[model samples]
Target chain A: SQKIEQNSEALNIQEGKTATLTCNYTNYSPAYLQWYRQDPGRGPVFLLLIRENEKEKRKERLKVTFDTTLKQSLFHITASQPADSATYLCAYNAGNMFTFGGGTRLMVKP
Target chain B: NAGVTQTPKFRVLKTGQSMTLLCAQDMNHEYMYWYRQDPGMGLRLIHYSVGEGTTAKGEVPDGYNVSRLKKQNFLLGLESAAPSQTSVYFCASRSQGTGELFFGEGSRLTVL
Candidate 1:
């Protein structure tokens, strides 16, 4: 019965700036959270993942922060480029199954 | 490595027709999943397999049935397709560590 929520609106930002996206959930407490990027006509590609016990995780230009108390996860893309423009999704495991958020489309303008 | 592959990238079926989507993984993963993506609903789990010969229902299994005769393949069957069932389907596989799920390109289906 986990319900994951993300900003359905598209995010527009200029180049060289940071883009931040949010993911929230209710009714279930997941042990870990994950982020993925999906281009048009393709399935989501994995980004970063953070655990409930961990405050943050990072991979190159991508960073993910998890707040268990807030039941939220924040994904940040530093120095975002046009190539990074895609729908970013946040997911959490409900037991062995994965539940995903609605997703936030990040449009990085050059 | 052809992590995950789904058959028939696109398809069109009449209402009340039936179809089966095939998914295969080469990663030797123990878990395989099927999901549907809608405009604003995100990805909803339809069915999943824990291992060879074992399948389980997920968040939205209605109107769909799944079979896993082998550990490497998962099949999702729609008994009677409806317009509402027209959504992009994705297949994914992962191991026990809960690492990022490896996904297929997705199958686009339309029911007229």
Candidate 2:
């Protein structure tokens, strides 16, 4: 079975600092990987998607890097603010199926 | 536009009772999914349909059933509700050739 391991269950970071989250997977090679942000009482919103062939993708203050060799993906939020606090989920797209990691909760303190 | 809509935003059921959650999408997406969100468990896939009349089991399909009779509508059924089934349910749709999933607000189900 494919397993996705996220760095931590929860992380606390100071505002304006860069927050980095890690996701590592094993036993499967995904065609693409996706990142999502989910606030409390809400469904997850898509943040970014990086294909296996793509090294990195960026949008605004968010950046995602996919390393197929290490079977890992890193998500970074630069100059983070309190509003950036939420649970982040990483998903692996194995052909027609999609699997999600447990998610990491991030708290940005002002 | 209402990208994806889930009916019965909140529902409560006694053990062994049965009910269904409705999900509709206006985007004409070919793939529809049913997922359950539990505290600390992220989201678990229940069942999904690649197209109308096609349903496939997902990671956590044991206690749930799904049907996609129309391209825009997908239904999830709980034959015998259990306390373990108490969780927020989300419906999502995706167009072919895209990796992004548009999700409904979600249905909060509480099985007592």
Candidate 3:
């Protein structure tokens, strides 16, 4: 079965450091991958989208890297702040549909 | 600009009741989608439309129906709501062939 996996556990990191999250998938080849940030009791807000051909993408302090060879993607938030704390979801295209993995919650200490 | 909006920002329904959630977008997007978000489940596509009047099933389409009669509006209807269907529903849209998605604030639904 093709499955999308992300860190089910919460991550706690220092405010000034970069926080890295991982997303892994099996048995599927997606054309593109996306990262979204969702706060409690709210819909996800789009962060970045990286095509399979692209190795990495960045927006301000957020960076997303896609590695089709390894069937994985990494999302990094540099200079993490308490305001940057949120659940990050990684999604991939699946036959015209988008599949999202269970998000990784990051809590940056103030 | 109201990029995307969902009617009935919040609702509480009894099991077996029926309701429709309306999503409207001003972005003139060609594709629209509906999804449900639950704890430990992230977001699951319930239904989507590639364009006006063209609806399609998604990963978890069961127990949900959709309509896109107009270019800028999509509706999600629940024939019979259930406790298991209680979730925060989101509406999103993007341009044709573009992988980017813009999302609405969301509709919080509770079933008793």
Highest DockQ against the true fold, candidate: 1
Model 2, range A20-87, lDDT digits (tens) per residue? Answer: 99999997668888999988888888899998899999999999999888989999999999999999
What's model 3's lDDT at A61? Answer: 93
For model 1, residues B19-89, the per-residue Cα lDDT tens digits are 99999999999999999999988999999998999999998999999999988999999999999999999
Candidate DockQ values, in order, are: 0.92, 0.75, 0.80
Name the runs in model 2 displaced over 4 angstroms: none
For residues B61-82, what per-residue lDDT tens digits would candidate 3 score against the true structure? 8899999999899999999999
For model 2, how does the per-residue alpha-carbon lDDT over B1-112 read when each residue is reduced to its tens digit? Answer: 9899999999999999999999999998999899998877878899999999999998899989888899999999999999999999999998676779888989999999
List, in order, the clash count of every candidate structure. 0, 0, 0
Say which prediction, candidate 2 or candidate 3, comes out ahead on DockQ: 3
**Docking class of predicted structure 1:** high
lDDT tens readout by residue for model 1, A1-110? 67899999999999999999999999666999999999999999988879889999989999899888898899999999999999999999877888999899999999
Q: Is candidate 1 or candidate 3 better by lDDT?
A: 1
- Weakest lDDT window of 10 consecutive positions for candidate 2 chain A: A92-101
- Identify the superior model by TM-score, candidate 2 or candidate 3: 2
Residue B56, candidate 3: C-alpha displacement in angstroms: 0.7
